[model samples]
Target: MEPVSLIVLLAMGTLAGAINAAVGSGSLLTLPVLLALGIPPGVAVRTNTIGILFSTFGSVYGYRREIAEEKGNLGPLMAVTAVCATAGALLLLASPGAALDVIVPILIVFALVMVIFQKRITAAIRAGAERRAARRGGAGSPATDGTDPSAAVSPGDDLSSAASIASAPTPARSPYRSPALIGTMGAASIYGGYFTAAQGILYLGVLGTFTGRSMKAVNSVKNLMSLIVNLAAASVYLVAHFVLRVEIVWLATAAIAVGALVGGYFGAHLAKKMPEWLLRGIIVVVALFALVRQVL
Candidate 1:
């Protein structure tokens, strides 16, 4: 590759990685650049998929503390996400591109709507959860899902965008069994597997609306889920390249990967440090950008 092209790829990859870690829609930055550089569509797709791993790894490390706290609630969700992502990747070749073009924008619109009305929706979900807990004799409640309530962060942080919820002494939990939460997450994972531009936004909307967790906490889990989905989908792509002769541009992949790693780590670092309001604003802004990008 020429030095100029190499420079461009790395730059795009880094920006995409950071955006993805912060609020998602990072792929929008990289994929188009790859195509513009004259990469074949198939090769660019596979290259971008594989390159995302480095970015995810960086973000995962950046959010390590929050992940450790939420580890118990993460396993089942990650497992389901992995399975869904694998299915999505396997189906990617057979699915019509036009169908995805139409469907994805609609999904983004719904996700944005959910985020916009997050407060009222979450209050209702929490109320419902409390009633269910009362009927079940208090096996689970809003603040405790078989975990220490003291360790929980307030859902209020979700909108206020407080400092890291890790520092907060609020109480709330991301429910493990809310069908809406889990379903949205699963759908996002599948979407991530296919292409992860705005998957983080979808996760934010779901986790934000149903789990009653702070944005930072929800964001930590969102990064983890994104990593898991990408890992699963990347595995499938690697297999296809080895056995089915699917193409990958190794040079482009390397450029994007290196750039993504740097971007993801720092983006996550910045996000973790931001006050609640700023983080919330970023999510809303990025989500809007994603919607516009898809619609156009």
Candidate 2:
């Protein structure tokens, strides 16, 4: 590659890494930049994945504390994600890109809509869950003073009740483990492996809606899951490159990877200070831009 093109790749990769750490979908920026610079589409996609791997590593390191705290909850999900992601990567290697071109825009729009109304959706789910709990309580015990059962616990029972709640079975323990949520996450991983653009948005929506965790926590998990998907897909790409003699732009990859590493470190710090709404807005705007670019 020419010096100018290398410089451009580095700059775009840096910006992409920062955006990815803050809100995700940074590939939307780097992939197009790579294509516009005259790289073959196949090589560009592989190189971008390799470059973004460094960004994800940096983001994970930045969020190490959060990730460690959530490791128990994330263990099963991560295993499932890795298996599904590898399947998606194999599908990508076998399928034609055009097959997903039409579907991807629709998926992006749906994710944007979900992000826009996430608060309302989450509120509704919470209300529904509470109502169910109330009903269950009413069925087993008659009301004594018209007080809420949750508030009627005796002082001696408080510790036990809290412990029971904490130790509930995984599925009933949290909305994050619901069947719907697990399915959504599985789908998101598959898509992430197959076509990485705007994947972070999908992950954010899934994690935000179901996990009942703060954005920082969700972002930490997102970074880990994305790292798994990229690693799996990159492995497939490497094998195919050797078997099919696919070209890879090593110089371009090195430039972008170095930039991504720097940007991701700073971006993780930025995420700690970013407001939720600001991050959501940025995700929606960038996803729309990518959708439009794909369509036109």
Candidate 3:
């Protein structure tokens, strides 16, 4: 382990953690570096997943208050994702990486699309909700009646803006019982447990599109759920390392874990301050870059 490689791993881990907490696809940034360093693919994947568990811890702690508000909604979703993650981890051991190569890019693209179109999609959702209200002779479209200021999110508006949070009374909703939301999360968790790349992107896609929360609020849940998925997968990796004698580059793992922990905590604070549009822009750029790099 040269000093240069150690520095690079630490730097990469820190950046990856921050990106993962603020946006997504942070693991994509680490995998190529690990592979370039001559670590085996299996070991690199396991190391990255295990390291991410610490990242999740730091981010979760940073979002502790928001998570406490959503705790009632989290129990069921956590159970679902953990179980799915276990299944995915077992599948990873049985299957070759080639099987998911194509699907990984597709998932990234889906996440990008969700972020890009989030405003319009949110408008349409609000429109429907307003229409239902109008049928009951309540306030109609915010655009038409102007009775509700918060109902219409302007084109330049960011749902996660500090101004919005201060002036408006928009509380985050989990809808954890929604079948569609559950289905999306279950699938993402499986892929997350198996591949460990771009899983946050997938979570953002589901949370951003369906949760109707500010980007910061959605991010709080994303970090928590991502943590649950990673821990379950890491559990499997640890079991294999001990029982099956699977190898881990412990030095590399230590560097990533320590770096990610610090990075994740700070990244959560960064995300909390970033406007929704900025967060979305970062998500788009990272996901697109990942897509092009993955495909090429």
Query: For every model shown, what is its TM-score relative to the native structure?
Result: 0.68, 0.71, 0.70
RMSD of each: 11.3, 6.3, 11.0
What is the Cα-based lDDT of residue 75 in candidate 2? 66
**Poorest 10 consecutive residues of model 3 by lDDT?**
137-146
Selected candidate, larger lDDT, 1 vs 3: 3
Report clash pairs, candidate 2. Answer: none
Tell me the tens digit of each residue's lDDT in model 2 across 1-296: 79998897788677668777877777766766665665655566778888877888888888889888777767667777888788887776776656545554565565566566756765676566558767878776746445575564566777877779767876545455566667778888888887676677678767776666665568888888888888888888888889987667888888889888887888666654778777666656655665556656
Better of 1 and 2 by lDDT: 2
Write down the lDDT of every candidate, Cα atoms only. 0.72, 0.73, 0.74
Quality of model 1 by C-alpha lDDT: 0.72
* Per-residue C-alpha lDDT of model 1 across residues 1-296, encoded as one tens digit per residue: 78887787798788768867886656656665665565654566668888877888998898899889878776778888899999888877555656756655565465555545655665676678667656777555654557775445566556345455456787556585566677778887877777655566667656765676665558888888888888998899999889988778888889999999999997655544667465445445655664555555
Once fitted onto the true fold, the runs of candidate 2 whose alpha carbons sit more than 4 angstroms away are 97-178, 270-296
User: Best-fitting candidate, measured by TM-score?
Assistant: 2
- Per-residue lDDT, model 2, residue 103, is 53
1 or 2: which has the higher TM-score?
Answer: 2
